[model samples]
Target chain A: MSVLALSVILAFVTPQAGSTPAPTAQSRQAGDAREMTLTLPHALRKGETAWLLVTVGMIGHNQIQLTTQSGKDLGNISPFGIRSGQAAGTYTIPVPAEALSGRRLVLRLSVPQAGGLHRATTTEEVTSVRLVIQRFGNGN
Target chain B: MSIYFETTRRDFLKTSLATAGTAALSRHLALAQAPAKYRRYSVTSQQGQKALVSYAKAIQAMLNLPADHPQNWFRNAFVHLMDCPHGNWWFYVWHRGYLGYFEQTIRTMSGDPNFAMPYWDWSDLAQIPDSMFNDVLTPVASAYERYTKDLQTFTAFIQPSLKNYWGKLSPAQIQQLNIRGYKTFDDMWNDVSGWTPTPMTGHLSHPGHFNPENTAFAPTPIARYLTLQNPQLSDSVKKNVSKGTVYSGLEPTNFATTYYQHIPIANPIKIGFNSSTTASHNTAPSKGTVFSTLEGLPHNSTHNYIGGGAGEGSPIPNGPWGNMTNNLSPVDPIFFLHHSNMDRLWDVWTRKQQALNLPYLPNSQQLPSYEKEPFLFYVDGNGKQVGPSIAKEYISMSRFGYDYEPGYGEEIIGKRNLVLAAKHPTASVEGLMKGNAATLTLSAAAIKTHLDSDTATSLFALVTVPRPTENSPNREFDVLVGAPADATNITADSPYYAGKVAFFCGMMHMSGMTDEATFIVPLPKRKEAFANLSAAAGNVAVTIRAVPSGGGASVLRAVTVQSL
Candidate 1:
């Protein structure tokens, strides 16, 4: 390989040294009711706000509903606030401490279509997810 | 489309110097343009990636300079540290000057004369470009380990030298620092330390009475909050940087805000893109603190998310954060890239003003004080201080001799002049949510001037909502006009969609026990959204609803549609 090509390859493949891996999403979907549950290493520390970072390849406008196993609703995460966009990529949904039942979070992912809308996600697509927690209040 | 109008931002300041006439506003006038010397590109672009290598080299060179050297990486950050503005109008122009000089420094150091800083369009990408993590570009690189291993280590390494440099400030520079509440070195250090003397006892050494923690310096590598693996902005930050919100920021014609408008207490209209026109950038406005939507929303939220301050990457409630979160934010390599995008947005906004033939700076009466606010601390790329400079000098991008490679909001520059609509009197809301019967009374001209997308005029609805209790299920509500009374769970695609009004009052008033909060929701200018309103014959009644973004009971108070 050329030196430039090798450098580019290494840049993509290499991971940072001494970095800890965050927990990933475990997906469970019935015919149409799609869901993903994430377990945190620890319960969100006191004074912390958090989000469920979901990487999905969405075809059209879509949103995710963040809630707990016990059905305590956090909120629906929508791109563009009141609006919806395809927003296909690694996107975050607020997973506040109140929604987490002892380090466990269940997300109800949906791509609610308007009349005649179809195929929010294609078959051949890759997805990933993680939980991010911050003790900072964001000056709340 | 030509970005430069014949006049400059300085001309807006000194309207007495030239005819402030509508001749500049004529749609047919031909404008002569000069190409900019540098062009900033998006980090996602290949050219931007190439520029990163040069940028990294410049960072490496700056990092190796002596502690007191003006161009030293840490010393360079101090220029921002000593003279940055927040919550006011100087916010945009100040950053433009800071980034412009730094870009020049990078050009000289990187040996790439064409090198302009590549911007991270987080509004689009939502992640710090993956390449930002490589080598000297990331703050955690080995090059920074010595100066920022920990607070004590960092202080010990740089304090004495910093103090010596502080002692040598020229009278004018010292005067500016004094105006910023930094009369002494310790006074300046207090901001860095987040220190507060006990109010009751007036004692400095009161333990537990002190702030939760001093944001003294950068955290240790082990405590490094953010990483390459988790560079994506959290969803909350993305909420502000969305295409809809960014364009809303650019929609305002005025650069600096009018004083008595769209603040917490008043229903005064005229919302501008940047904040209040204040005497000094370092201080709060004499009227009231107002941050332009762009500054308050996307600008701040992005900074916090990257610094792990916004519910990401486990940042502590207070104390040492990644250099991006604090006054020393310039210490982060990503700061330049992040700010370059901000400067570009200002350019985009300026170009749109040129297209609209609108004044892009404070009016002439407000000019002298606005421009005279001294910026004395900046050191040029050549190691000499930028002596006796003022805010007006940094008003235009041409001052730095750079332009932006067209990014997200540049489409506004090509927007043809919106047709003018005849002036109309004030309009008011007639009814509330009564089985889809909520109505707004409007003058006939309101349809073309306010509701129609074809006109330059804008009309905003001042939405009033009762302060939600801590137990309120959702703190955000979506505003819709002419929606069915029963309409629920509608998205942006709905024709009834106006905009969302969030109860970010505690985020606004710091805290509120108040009865209500009012949000200014600019009615969507899309003609299709108001198709029904134009068709109404008798009493022009428009249905309005404030449904929660989340599924819950609506706590919307009152909404008033009026024009100034």
Candidate 2:
């Protein structure tokens, strides 16, 4: 850090090949998220538990970053990991107790794939799969 | 969607000519013409004859109303439950047997082999514009018109008696009574189409308990009395009258528990709520069949309603089918008829509906889109398996199979406590050949499984899967099970149980993939033993099977003890 700062002050810094531009505040604001889709098992019963998985990706590289948006927080997401070529990974999620079975819900997956160096982002809304929970017990 | 073929006149004439060559023309024609009437012994007697006549007239009058009119729909549904000309009074007997007796009378009189009544298929009206209740260019329009007029006439005839019961009522009160409907015969006489069944006596008063003959609440025996006094009939008709009331076979709890109970009742056969005082009677009390019948437990925590062994239904230990007092339906008199047919079929198939021949998860394990205890009505035959050619064969009996009664075909009750089967064959040479020849037929096992630990004491059957070799393709299969023959002596075999309780295993797998076969098992008539035994100490078997499609299927076996 000291050498880079001193070099900048001395005007000795030079741009290197394959160096991408950092995102500006304005670019980050303009490049919003697009194309969101959530996937899950088709059904779950009331009072039953199930795992919910989420994924987010961007259209182009080096222009956008994706993140989770707003909704009722059921459970926390898994630790993030990096994909070498595909730029995709998995995350485990939880289904809430009050969440009804046999119904669909939309979860916003932000702009695009995270870690897209210098990429602009856009968003899209896609319907998620439905979940249905069943009843239980004897002598009903 | 059915395949059709053309036939030649030459073939038909040739067959007729061949037949004529074998016998004289007159003899052949006479042979084809008909034979003498076949008369069976009659069960009706002098004491019940008058009541039977009155009941018939009441039913006919009730039937002569618009299908959508609340009263007409209610009465029709009631009659349907009591006298469905289908698989006898199976559902009625299972849900309410009193209605079964009434249905038997109707069956006896009509001489219909099967209890099939005409149904107003609403799908026909679904395509028409304006209202589903009416159609512009069909016979249905005329039917509806006649129904409306008959309802109005009946209402006018019954209005005065209702007024006399609660004398000099205010305009607002009278309007409320008319709007909501009538309860007593007098109230109905004053306003036939708008009477409600109230708890206490009104103008059509009679000194009889509601639960006569230990059946459902009696309607105060007003119909017979009125018919006897009518001046329209001849002396011979009056002389042939009978007087005792037959049970109406209404299970008050089944419909009341579903969305139907919310519908307002007007001269209902069974009074749902106590309408005598100003207090609201809709709130169920702490104890009694209304709420206590459910074992005071959550639906999910309680035993599977259609699953498990015996002694379940309504009215607690009495079982819903055995008790005649439960309200079956309010919007339809055919409710009794429909149930009766359902029960009769039950008598035929017994445990076929709860077989393990289909795909299911073992020990109450539920599949996606379903929970452990969630149940579905197949609409097909009581869990019997069939092939594509005969897929549409199991139509509602009331609509077709017009002459269905004793000895229509043959009744095959599967061996008691033996596993019934519906096997899925492989799609290879052998499987294809089996599928081509596999028609809908029921068979039985000779040996019965005893109620002992080593015997497994569990229900089992085979499920059919097509193309089991296919890679993760969606497959379909059917469940098969063994049931008691119609002549089974349940009391002799199972001394402690009173009625049947059907139990079904969850989805099972065939080969590598999941199969969707469904089956139900019923408890034989020995409920007392079940009550006396400790549930925690007993070991129960929970079987799951998975059958693949397009021929050969694999099987998975699992069992568990009673967690309770």
Candidate 3:
């Protein structure tokens, strides 16, 4: 948030606010999200906890939101126990059993600088994303 | 932007001398006499090891600077702490600018006219160069023990100056912080303190807010998580930086498109070489932005592994860890070498895109806001403030007058790896809805295209989920398709597992905005997922369901399947 980064490939001069072109097209429909589908393994037993390991680039704080395909709005996923984003990018998002109950599911996640209020118009990306099932109650 | 004028204000002289042939000569002669670019060599080379000696000298000088000085080693790390972006398109360009200027500082301080930063090229040399473990090259050395002896000493030495710097920030920087969700200086400081007011004083709390004690203010010698005794990366980390993974890191053709990967994989997995794009370099993860495989893979994993944050990029101990794990990473000498590799990978990816005759960067039209985004915080070799520079200035290594010594993936140069355009990519159908499950009936033609080895069109489920609200109780949810009833949570290993959707909680619910949000999710491409469809069939029935991540109700508005 402290810096603004743009890839001006064709021009070197910084454009004045009004003179800058509108985004030509969005990769997706609404926001800046570019998604590549990944496979999800591991199953959670009742009341079990799982870790959503996401490799982030540099933003300090991130937020991840989840929802069921039935459109169940789960609030921001809590950090696995006390471990949140310790590094510049590695985040531990704990997914509890209540959220993984159904035979099938759909979720909407956002690991934000802090996802709230302003529409996310900034440029950002994530690297590796996966869920680690916590069979024991120790590591969050 | 012709820096040609930088040579001299000889406009009149050039104009008078420029005959038709002279004009051509001006172009070709300048071309033939290309200036010598600084060469960043691999650490394994003698030249690179020599550069490390100078790098050590420069780092020591920066460390010796007064705490109040902008070029002080800690304050330089502050530049990264304050401005670096991860998980976004600017990830590459921002770092390029950071490194370019830092390299200049090294040149100036080390007194080496030909000095260029040496890169670790982790794929080639998996262990840290033994030279880095010696003297000032390691953060654990005696030189760093002075300022970073402990939190009390560090806080006493650095806080006052940092606060003064914060007080001096321009209004524009403050405004950017506002959009980035830091409303006040206290908000930013709270992240350092890891103390969030229960009620929301500026909403500064983040991922590990649940921790009673979360702070990044400790950077002692002990804070160096990896010692010379354990300098090797874990086996998993070695895999992350393996040659094949680096190739995948260079695979995405588009500079940026979707949050994760907007386009289908070139080879079932080969999309998103670069990270996704978003609004601000520091913007939160939204529908528009997700992690590119490279940043999410090698870069982050490497940081965590060295810092021992996650013990090789998985769940490890919740760490005070090392400086490498936190925003204060540059405190460790290894940080520079690690970033050099990251920057090198970006260079390789850029050249690969250029060789394929594809756009290596986002055209202005793709992200209009890009050009206006100024990188405001950087210190130059003379210890002078170097920005408000924009991203374009650092988009190419040429901007910094440097080039990398040949390493892995440089082979893409002059090689013609053809990429096939999507053919009949527009075939799609609607998915019939059931409880959390959608039955998408596909035609034989749709199945064939999806199954095509050469021109496989990626299938995505445009799932409609609720928009993020500060009041929302649920933050994360898992998605699974055709899994058994007992199989609820899933990871990448499971074929029936779809993906996980997460939200940043803690924002006020927007009023009058659309309540429903649509996400373009790529369908899993595992052959096992479509085994039944091998025979040409009229249609297939697949059940996609949403698992409540945190105890919450299901509310899927609709699911549309499309191939692109």
In terms of TM-score, the best-performing candidate is 1
lDDT of 1 by residue, B301-360 (tens): 566556545232334433344566656778888888888888888888776666555666
Residue-level lDDT tens digits of model 1 in A1-140:
00010000001011212333223345566334345676655433222334443344332213343345554444333221110112233332334333554445665544333331212222222244445443311110
Clash number for every model? 0, 180, 87
Interface DockQ per candidate: 0.02, 0.01, 0.04
TM-score of chain B taken alone, every candidate: 0.68, 0.23, 0.64
lDDT of 1 at B115: 95
lDDT computed for candidate 2:
0.23
Interface RMSD of each: 24.1, 34.2, 19.3
- Scored against the true structure, residue B351 in model 3 reaches a CA lDDT of 59
What TM-score, computed on C-alpha atoms, does each candidate reach?
0.57, 0.23, 0.55
lDDT of 2 by residue, B242-337 (tens): 000000011011111111111222111111111111111111121111211011111101111111101111112221111111221222222232
- TM-score head-to-head 1 vs 3, winner: 1
Deviation (Å) of B240 in candidate 2? 47
Better of 1 and 3 by lDDT: 1
lDDT of 3 by residue, B35-93 (tens): 64799888889998999999888888888889899888888888876777766778778
Report every candidate's CA lDDT: 0.58, 0.23, 0.56
